[model samples]
Target: MASDSPVYLLLGATGGIGSEVAHRLADDGAQLVLGARSEDDLDDLAAATGGDAMPLDATEFEQVQAAVSHATDTYGGLDGVVNFVGSVLLKPAHLTSIDEYRTQIEKNLDTAFNTVKAAGRPMMRSGGSIVLMASAVSRTGLKNHEAIAAAKGGVTGLMRAAAATYSGRGIRVNAVAPGLIGGGENFASQMSEQILSSEAGRKQSEKMHALGRVGTPEDVAPAVTWLLDPETDWVTGQVIGVDGGLGTVRPG
Candidate 1:
């Protein structure tokens, strides 16, 4: 990337949606700092996209700091960030354990907090953008999505508040609330045999979207990339949904 080219820090680079966003930004000739816990996945993605890979554990504060520091050094300054670290626990609210709730909160909220704090450091230099991964569940209710929904709600709130606080300093904060993005091992891992096997469950999930199909990572990737682009200079402090009109009628 040239001195004038935008630099983007992409967290959760191993996941389906994150990888797509990284590729999208790279395609637009943006310099990328890809962060994920899986070194091999990060290496492969970075190599394929001509970006640098940073093995970062989002939960580890120092690790995140180090990765962002490396990105700032390599890119000369930060221009944008896409945080995609999130986890989901699928269980009825009554059956969900406290530990399971904590896991989702830690994975979604804390990881995002760490990445934003770290990335905010160098982003201040160039007046950058920050895109947080939220969920349609944040704005709507669901059966077994309690933990993730609560955490993502917090994420959306955090992004809005951060946007207000940071905009004066030239950093824009926003969130993408996606529907059921069908790609990524993360989403597949959340799907259960019980849910797939039960006809009612399948129908309920499928019908929630007006589009009659679940979302794909590719479907949500463009929204994430566009929000992080410098082109969206005036857009900030908003939680835009990538769902296919689910939030409008059926709160999927």
Candidate 2:
């Protein structure tokens, strides 16, 4: 029941979850500005969803700023922004290289930081909602998830502080922490290949979730869209888990 045709700027729009969010928002009567690293991919998505597409590298502040400015200018103003940029590094801290650690920080924490800073600047005068992607690992201790956990943990902290700083200005900032979402072309594909390649491995992963299964991009898009919707104007600074109980429950 979304109205007003709110304008939303979406980063990582070509990714699995981001694509789903774009389609969901479009169906909700949203006007979307989609950003991603590949112009062709963005173009395809834009064509499919009737959204505007731009090439963006979220880690770069200037590019992010440009994308935000474009959205604001094109739509007259921006009503929301969703950042889907992130990376997954599942190596032990001792085994992770400095470069890998830096990459993780840049992809997760830096992407979120730059998106907030750039989007916040424009949305400052006219308040809007901002949704960021966090991970269940940020709150749960998972083996070999040291690097990504640390990075997404920073994202959670950033979301909270930004929410607090902007709430009074009518800006709402929140995050969605997802567990192992399969059927996506992302870093998780590597883990999915290993964890879902065998029947036994698949069962082991399914048992990790109370729901007895992993998630999909479709399962996550609704929560993100809800956060962006006007009805949730009162909710901010919250980290919601769309993890099928993976972060909270232990199957006995």
Top-scoring candidate (lDDT): 2
Q: TM-score of every model?
A: 0.91, 0.94
Candidate 2 lDDT over 111-213, as tens digits, reads 9999899988778887989999998889789899888999999999999999999988899999999988788665345445666767897788788888989
Computed on alpha carbons, the lDDT of every model, listed in order, comes to: 0.81, 0.88
The regions of model 1 sitting more than 4 angstroms off are 1-4, 184-200
**Which residue pairs come into collision in candidate 1?**
none
- Stretch of 10 with least lDDT, candidate 2: 184-193
Q: Between which residue pairs do clashes occur in model 2?
A: none
lDDT of 1 by residue, 146-169 (tens): 888889989988898889878888
Number of backbone collisions per candidate: 0, 0
TM-score of 2: 0.94
